[model samples]
Target: MSSKLNIFEFSNPSIRTLHISWVAFFITFLVWFSHAPMLAFIKEAFDLSSQQIKALLILNVALTIPSRIVVGMLVDRFGPRIVFSALLFTGSFLCWGFAFATSYEMLALFRFLCGFVGAGFVIGIRLVGEWFPAKQVGVAEGIYGGWGNFGSAAGAMTLPTLALLFGGDDGWRYAIALTGAIAFVFSFIFYINARNTPKGSTYFKPKRSGGLEVTSKGDLYFYLAMNIPMYIALAVLAWKLSPENLGLLSELATNTLYVVLLVLFVFQTSQIWKVNKEHLQKGVAEIEKYKFKQVAILNWSYFVTFGSELAVVSMLPLFFMDTFELSAVTAGLLASGFAFMNLVARPSGGWLSDNLGRKKTLSVLIAGLSVGYLVLSQIDGLWFIPLAVVATMCCSFFVQAGEGAVFAMVPLVKRRMTGQVAGMAGAYGNVGGVTFLTVLSFVDASTFFMVIAGCAALCFILVQFLDEPSGQMAEVMADGSVELIDVA
Candidate 1:
């Protein structure tokens, strides 16, 4: 690692890799969310209810939680270039399938599977981490994440306009299909141009492929424990579509999914044990030992940070329209501001983490987010719209910035497991969405925001326990050599 590779000065190769990686992620997100802005059109086309629409939204993310874990392992083992490109190309096909779906069931199936592409975020994180040194990883990942995340915002801004330009009952379908085609073609370009690392740099491989390697017995148990929540989230989603809730799922189908989920959980736990059994018994060196609990804490933190962001962004427009008695168009534009903060605040969060300490930066951002949400909980039509906008914007900064800070620490946790680590953290974001949205069904919109604030406050306390990355992590190379990657 070299100080000369600070944020301002980096090799063109690193910069180019970052740019390409982020764009790849951006395009994936664009494809992932191309349906969102056109939901009204889809609703009309399908004659859907508000509940079914929400269920469709829920379905969009249902597969993502598990797909992220699978994709993470694939990236860690096979490298990001192949994994990401394959995801985009295959996901593009799914997007096209969704566009042509004549039945709601078929559309839901394709949209749910498209969630797999959301794991594109994990691939770019590992790619950017490989290209940049530890000193600059924060900003590089920040830029990668911030700019890449804007794809959803970009979709919100552009897809509707594109649909209008096409001008027909099926215009939304064409607009969405165009995004898929772009993703499909770019997948080939990404595969051809993107390298796992700069020439002459080693692309480090994990010791095992199927599961994460843990250094100690405690970490092994902790890893198993962390996996439980992901399954729980899936179960929650199933329940939401079950007869007891939205009634979109038959009792038999819902129960079958639950049983399958349980079996999958058991299989995953078995793989985890098999991968790390020897290492847990032999014991790793002190320098190589890192707590899996750190990853666990961040998992819960992101469940709130990015999770709330996802859940809130989905419902905010309707929340505004109902509460403020405003037009859908105006409410949607106002809600767009929440996601718009990603372009700047997310990078600012990472920059702050780099200048300050990771824990300190996370604590401050979480606190601000908690307070911001609390203030948001108090909003009413009596308040001025500008004041309301200010409140939302203030909360957006903390929420998106907190996301940047959380990832600031992600790459630092374990180098070999960075993809898996990031993947799980990312899964929790979906988990939070499922969890918070369930709460929203039971409570008022104001209480929903307050619930997230409470969750953030709990995560803030947990942030105090994280050990800042400062020294180095040792990764054993294939040639019986040890490579020291900087974590400071």
Candidate 2:
């Protein structure tokens, strides 16, 4: 609970909890992304076409948008301990399946399934929020997020070396399978070691499940409206794979998906109304009511922050290679500075949020994010490579820190619903990624950066509406007692 505790002091249970949780998250990411660096080997082994390769890449992230939402609901109902373990355990098999696939169809299916592991990040957000007090939750969540996120970079760096070390046409399979093995072993370790909450602390649960609860009729409407984008992102992915685009999905299949999405949206709206209609009809007491607007704002903030990060990181190396006329290795190494900033920048953002006011910190970061991307939009062939890298790193720092700052306020919104809140926010991050990437496919690099900058600028305007967390959040215990959790 003390923000001042030495981070390495594992003697403290909370610190130990934070360490374990992040490691669980890290392994999930390692498994989730283990294929990225080994894609060349995979393509060679499967004799895949350029279109199939691109389809594989798109399929990789396709499931995570909905998976995060489902994982969030599950973690809220069943607790992070079991949910995280189950995700990693199942994902490990998917990893192995992808590793040893003899055909592109098998590879694509497994890779798509592996996207479920990305939801592991959301589970840890709730876990860290449970163990750490408000004074320290931001930094704890930041450390968890920042460190865990590095697993992708780690996989990218190490998987290729691992493949070569194995030395064969199937080397990539062995390398990827090793990542799955590690995830499988660690799943048991995480389940055995992690606790739902600190000793004797009540593990809060949502009063109902299926959809997020809303206090006001307007909020209910807002919650329903927000769900639309997630579905739209899925539809976009489907469209990208359809006959008109990459032709991965037939026209009939794509149309079926569209119809399915529409039906699901209607079903989900009904669920939302089912869960919240009684609460809205009776009116929520002010003490018991929390603003859905906070969740909405955080969703948009993450949409731009983490969303842009995803979009940029995907294209940055190519951007550097083309614009700077550098080799793939050098460009990739330089571009990695963007992701590498996560380690320090995210924690700094969270620490700033904890010490400074949350709204003020987010405002400054979002403003900087807008400016940073606007600067990036100007980079060109004539720009000095060092200066371009500096500009990229600057933008990355704001983008990642803004992610930290957004989640810093997530747990503060509603304690019992932290998983759902984090889930929706996390899903929006993917929505942002899908949206921005779809935009990128239609535009040039500078235009893409400008679009992201424009989105960030809009998010900056929205951040002004966010009410800072103060005093304490009230949650009811199972025994009909009120417990106040600090947010101030």
Candidate 3:
């Protein structure tokens, strides 16, 4: 494998796959966030209150937590090519529905559905993992993630101007609908161009479909325990929208939703047990067994890395505007710097992980991020604007780089279960966002930053327990033959 990335070498099928996969992911993000920049217009059109607006924001991320898990299963089963295209194609309608929504209810429903596109990130992780060799997988996944993730910033930068170009009360509607159209057309393009795997390589599927397969009884319990936080995050979202918070849901409805979530958790636990019981009872082959703790640590790592990214991106603009009394446009432009770092910082993180060793690179990045957030916690109205901007951008780099480093290790965890693993980790990223943002509602900016810093410190400690990937992971072929995939 080349130490340098020759991304322009399209003659290489891996390069071509990398290019197309990132574009698909980019468009998914663009479509998923198309409504964000247009929210002001939508709010005006619907005459939405502050609470209603907040509810819409909550609704946007509400479904993505579980969607990643479900999409992971689908990706592992049907492969990324079909699943990603389907998600984009189906999400197009959801985007369009939100665009032309006549009522807040319609808008809310469509936005909630649009959240499904957020899971598209998990699909590409599996796809990229399948195509790239382990030596290059980290950088490849980083490029896919870093560049593809820029779609949100792109939407923020362009969609509002696009709405202006359309010129009317409904301009925002047209702007958003256009994003859907792009996604709809690109879905076919992606389907046509993308392959499940490189020629002559097998695409491994999970032995069972309903839940992640576990090697040991302890891991089975660990997997189930890890699931609790996702449900708890959902419950927090429910509480936020309940009568006590935003009043979007009545007590009865909130309680019903809680019951429904509980029931689903029970059902999922049963599925997990059903999927792994035989394996646990009989014991997994030594060659086939991989540690679940790797996944758990990565999950927490993402919870802090990508989680803080989501949470901070949501509030940074406001934090800047409120703290410095800056113009909204100026604050927004400055805040955009945070997301823009994804382009270079993420890939750099991946490259570092590839060369510097994954665990060491991730730990260093997390430690830096903790310190970065701690610095951010000190920013106040008296701070120099230029200095604050630099501080913010510096922190932003580590936050995104940490994300790059985390995913850099994901595919190597278990090749056959890459999708499930990525799904869980990706879901935790959303969980982090929800948890941090929820904390923000109850505290000041300094406290929020400190909380994230604390989480990062804890994650840094937890990451110490992660064993670096080496040797090869064994997967069973369709004909029941075993093949070894290199991880080191």
Candidate 4:
């Protein structure tokens, strides 16, 4: 494998995979967020109340937290090619359902289902990890993640105009269905072009299927402990939609969902134990062992970085509009800068992780994220608009860059479990979004910024405990022969 990446080298199979894989991810995001930009048209068409609109927003992310983990496991078992292609194809139908829904209930159901599309990010993580070497995986994964993430921004930039051009009450519907068509077509394109791994390279699979295989009994408990926050985040979302809050869901429905979540968590716990019981009892070979805390710390790091990005993107436009007394269009255009930075900022983080040590790079980026948010906590209407925009962009750079750094280490943790590792970290990012957004519900803008900064500071400290990836990981092949994969 070459130490240097020539992104323009299209003839290279790995480069081709990187380009097509990111486009697959981008289309999923485009479908996932297609509703957000055209919400005004839909609201007008359906006569939605403020509370109902809030419910739609909450429902949009309701399934994504768990879906990411599920997709991760699927990617590991089935490989990225099939799993990603299927997700894109299926997501298109959901987009169409949401676009053409005649009733609010129908709209809510499809939007919640659309949350599955967001898990498309997890599939590419495993795909990109397979194609790139340890030396270049950082930036390669960065370009995959950073550019793929821009799909949401791209949708926001273009979809509204598209709806307007379609020119009627049903224009939003047609515009959204068009996004679905692209996803459906691209699904076939990705499937036909993408390969799971390089020629002659083995695609390692997990020894057990159900849950992540932990090394020690202690790590087994730690893995279980780490999952509690994800369930808690889901519960918070349920509460927001419950009759006591937005009244979108009746008390009976909310309680039933709560019971369902509890049952699912118990079933998941058993699956984790099932996957690890035999291994822990036999005692894992030292050479085959990897620390579960590496996974845990990355989870928290992503929670701080990507989680804050989701929360901020949702609120920044409103924050700017109110704070500066600007029109909606003006505030929205200004706020777009934060998301726009992903194209460059994320790849730069990966480049730094590749050149600088991963741990050091991650730590510095997290610290920068903390400081950036702290600086944001001080912004006010008294500040000039251009300066505020610059401050917001600067803060987003660290947030998104930290996210890139987190995933850069994910594939290195356990080559076989890269899908699951990426999935868990990706899920935690949503957990962070839910947790922080919940905080924003009760606080001022400055307080919300301070809360994120405080959490980033704690994550910065946790990152110090990470042992740098400097050696090789040993994987047992199907024939019981050992294969060594490089991490450093």
Q: Which prediction has the highest lDDT against the true structure?
A: 4
Location of the lowest summed lDDT over 10 successive residues in candidate 1? 1-10
Compared with the true structure, what per-residue lDDT tens digits does model 4 show for residues 1-488?
A: 66679999999999999999999999999999999998898889999998999899989998999999999999999999999999999999999999989899999999999999999999999999999999999999999999999999999999989988999888899999999999999999999999999999999999888899999999999999999999999999999999889998889999998999999999999999999999899999998999999999999999999999999999999999999999999999999999999999899899899889899999999999999999999999899889999999999999988888998899999989999999999999999999999999999999999999999999999999999998799999999999998999
Residue 231 local lDDT, model 3: 100
lDDT of 2: 0.91
- 1-488: candidate 1 lDDT, tens digit per residue: 54333444435778878888889999989989989989999999999988888788888899999999999899998999999999999988999999889998998899889898899999998998888777777777888898999998999899999999999899999999998999999999999989988788777777877788887887788888888988998999999999998888999999999999999999999888888887767878787788887898889888888999998898889888988999999998998899999988888888888778888999999999999999999998888887898899889999989898888889888888889999999999889988998898899988998999999999999989888888888877778788888788
lDDT of 3 by residue, 1-488 (tens): 66677899999999999999999999989988888888889888999998999999999999999999999999999999999999999989999999999999898899899999899999999999998887888899999999999998999989999999999899999999999999999999999999999998998899899989989998999999999999999999999999999999999999999999999999999999999998888878999999999999999999999999999999999999999999999999988888999999888889899888999999999999999999999999999999999998899889888899999999998887899999999999999999999999989999999999999999999999999888999998888789998888
**In lDDT terms, how accurate is model 1?**
0.88
Candidate lDDT values, in order: 0.88, 0.91, 0.93, 0.94
TM-score of predicted structure 1 = 0.97
Residue pair clashes in candidate 3: none
Candidate 4: deviation at residue 144, Å?
A: 0.5
Off by over 4 Å in 2: none
All candidates: TM-score: 0.97, 0.99, 0.99, 0.99
Look at candidate 4 and tell me the lDDT of residue 275: 95
Model 2 lDDT per residue over 1-488, tens place: 45664688879888899999989888988998898888788878877888998898889889999899989999999999999999888988888998888777888888889888889999999999998888888888889999999999999999999999999788888999999999999999999999999899999999899889888888888899899999999999999999999998989999999999999899888888888988889888787899999999999999999999889999999999999899999999999999999998888889989989899999999999999989999999999889999999998999999999998899999999999999999999999999999999999999999999898888999999999999999999989889999998
